[model samples]
Target: MSTAGTMLVIGATGTTGSRTTARLAAAGHRVKAASRRAAPVAGAEPVAFDWHDPATHAAALDGVDRVYLIPPLGDSDPAATMLPFLRKARDAGVHRAVLLSSSAIPEGGPAVGAVHQALPGLFGQWAVLRPSWFMQNFTGAHAHARSIRDEGIIRTATGSGRVAFVDAEDIAAVAVRALTDEQAPNTDLVLTGPEALSHDDIAALITEVTGRPVAHHHLSYEQMRDRLAQQLSAEFAAMLAGMDRAIAEGAEDRVTETVQRLTGRPPGTFRALLEREMPVLPSDPAVR
Candidate 1:
């Protein structure tokens, strides 16, 4: 709403958080970019913030009337830390809050769902953004991206399942509107890309666009979970594998207009994203 009080953005160094902070600052709104190191972010002030450390909460909340919340990464029960900080935030005069959530997780479902459930009651003006899988997963430092780069393979338990992978920039746009609009969405919004694509479709698209040999390797749920366990907690690995299984069951096999409706522009396509982020080989005649 009014650009009087500052906006506090947690996880300011993250995908959507960084973009949100930059957009806010570019629009001339005051922003406090919160990260563990309190690293400087362009166009915003840096502040140290840790979800588990309540001592970092008050300082981040000071002079902040609105907040963009990015829950602790890999925390299965984020509500434990987030709820407490949220209560403290409300007490410290924060009125509007926008929470980042996932499309697979419904309100009160599990993981960040618990925080989503508590948000409405905590702030009079609030919005919960439930976005689908990010398109950047295949281009950035995500495991999928690593595998694609190293082995030219994308492994997953989701066999033939499709996802409407939205862009992090689109999610950030929606977050900005939710945080700055006079009237918050006041409801959970499920954001998705314009089309639903299976992992096989993604692999083919990457191969064609980048002129690289890429393939999707289907794995059993147990296989995927055990592989992920090497890098993540057993519980978290299981949860991620379960999500893949759900995708295989057609849980995420749909697209939505949420991004366009909120941002007044179309969501980005996977092909477009790949072309923009990946270099096309000179040997590929399609682009040459």
Candidate 2:
């Protein structure tokens, strides 16, 4: 957890990764931004690193004592690839490790959960960030954003269930603290925004802020799964649909103060994020 050593940020071009990299670099912390293409990131050195490619692991680990891990996306079982790399990282002298997981998944539950379960054993200074659904899903290139832009509709199987959609910036701020703080969190943190909102509420906010008409289209679990299967594996699609069903059952209904407690500031709200990132709809366009 030495501040002198470099921090490696995997998925540097991604939602929270990019922001985490920026925050670390801006704070004068040494950072290595890791992406599959070794794409350049501002304020940090960029290196090519893929979870599936063990060959790229050594170079990325060089001079790196801390790591911000974004598990390989779309893989139902990330522990299969992640555990091996983690062991290699430990052998390479890395100290602190912070993993990005989801609120929907818990330690030893599924997907990144297995990695979460093994983190404390791998590194003394380790934290698992389980953030709720991201607010960026409506402003960025996510399916909701794309659908909102092209069709003015938000489709989901999540009925009236509300989620405290957190902002990536807030998540990054907490991550920077976890990485550089004298003491690591050393425990799993569930991060969420200030308020829990449903899809209909989100669509209304977007419409209110952007002056554009947007509607939420509710779909059955089967319909959502089938629709998502067109773009994702059948298993992944089913899992996603199942998450929506879970949401419908009020699983993601509560809010937490993790962001505020860690970052010394209250987490931003969804409406605030929308106003800042998208005050107006795109004339023609495009999270974990």
In the order shown, the candidates' Cα RMSDs to the true structure are 2.8, 3.0
Any runs in candidate 1 off by more than 4 Å, and if so which?
Answer: 1-4, 281-288
Model 2 TM-score (2 dp) = 0.96
Could you give candidate 1's per-residue lDDT for residues 1-288 as a string of tens digits?
555479999999998999999999998899999999999999999999999899998899999999999999988889998998999999999999999999999999888999999998999999999999999999988999988877788999999999999989999999999998878899999999999999999999998998877889999999999999998899889999999999999999999888899889999998889989887744423321
Candidate 1, residue 100: how far the Cα is off, in Å: 0.4
lDDT for each of the candidates? Answer: 0.92, 0.92
Total clashes, candidate 2?
Answer: 0
What are the clashing pairs of model 2? none
Give the Cα error of residue 112 in candidate 2, in Å: 0.6
Candidate 2 Cα outliers beyond 4 Å, as residue runs: 1-4, 282-288
